[model samples]
Target: MSGSDSAAATSRYSAFLFDMDGTILNSIAAAERIWGVWALRHGLDVASFLPTIHGARAVDTVARLALPGVDPEQEAIGITLAEIADVEGIVEISGAADFLRSLPADKWAVVTSAPRDLAARRMKAAGIPVPAVLVTAEDVAAGKPHPDGYLLAASKLNVDARDCLVFEDAAVGIAAGEAAGATVMVVTATHFHPLASPHPSINSYETMFTEIDSDGLMLLQERGA
Candidate 1:
């Protein structure tokens, strides 16, 4: 579903919603280092468990595992603290900063499964600007795979969810966006392998560009178009 393969190449939306970690920046190395250590400590297979942790809140991911003697909330706090302390290897997705900068600031929001502090830190570390409207894990009663975050972001932007476009990189986040009634665009900048999706996708923001019409609607399209 690369940009060139779909009608999304010329799609226009009133606003854009973006996921934080995998969508706007590459935090896989830092995340895996911390989560991998925690997984080993819990007697879980690092390789098998790491993939499940992305695109959702730590508490939700931990609770879903239902590990014996583990308090999901407490463990999530510990993990967040560790993540906040380690921003090493975090970098912006190619052209992410420039692409975001090109958009009207009020026309976009960042919806992330990461807690507020961690999201801010990671965005800062990657040199990505923090959006004025950010819906973090704590802001919503539920994380991705639920529409709360994206819906809230749309609400805060004073736009209809259906009129917004969501940019995401994980299944749960994509589900959340769709649940919010937004068209989704997948970002595979951090993916180790190709992703299969019906939604339009881009390997990096470098492949796309933004335009604002006279009516102020934002258009997302392939670079040369």
Candidate 2:
């Protein structure tokens, strides 16, 4: 790694905020299946519709593409219900469970654009324990790229937004983290569209480990270090 890259990775923070899907949980397969079916049913192009789905609430996606006179809210609810029942391929991102388990529960949270129930179901399917502070779509008036959810999570954790590190995979979630004044780390573990941010990025948590210092400060480091 370059000097600047190493420097960015070694930076410390008081707390961490994470996006659920694509970051902590690998729900891509399930998401694609559900959204693809939904798109076909709506007479929309699956390829064109999939790009706008991630990192945003289903309701928002529906509102953006639903045909005239289609109830966006109802359509979103149907998608959510279907997603909750469709956990066929849901799994925790590699090393996500270990990384989270090593941290003090109070020092991290999940801020997702999914409804609470759907988020809970996904986590359960992936065998991830529900985080102590979960900011779901229903909890915020605005979704990702709005900063409401991330800000709410930092507030709940009693950590300053500036002292929080955020892990995300989607552009919208990165925007939210940046807007909330947190250092955003893009997770490259999944196949995601390119992001234009200059934040440090990680491809896998598998070779990383967390340590708590004598001062009770936690830091994430590479495994061999």
> Best candidate per lDDT, number?
1
lDDT of 2 at 190: 77
TM-scores of the models, in the order given: 0.96, 0.93
What are the per-residue Cα lDDT tens digits for candidate 2 across 112-142?
Answer: 9999999999999998888899999999988
C-alpha lDDT values of all predictions: 0.91, 0.86
Per-prediction backbone clash count = 0, 0
lDDT of 2: 0.86
**Residue 155 CA error for candidate 2 (Å)?**
0.5
TM-score of 2: 0.93
Kindly report which residue stretches of model 1 are placed more than 4 angstroms away from their true locations once superposed. Answer: 1-5
Give candidate 2's total backbone clashes: 0
Local error of candidate 1 at residue 45 (angstroms): 0.9
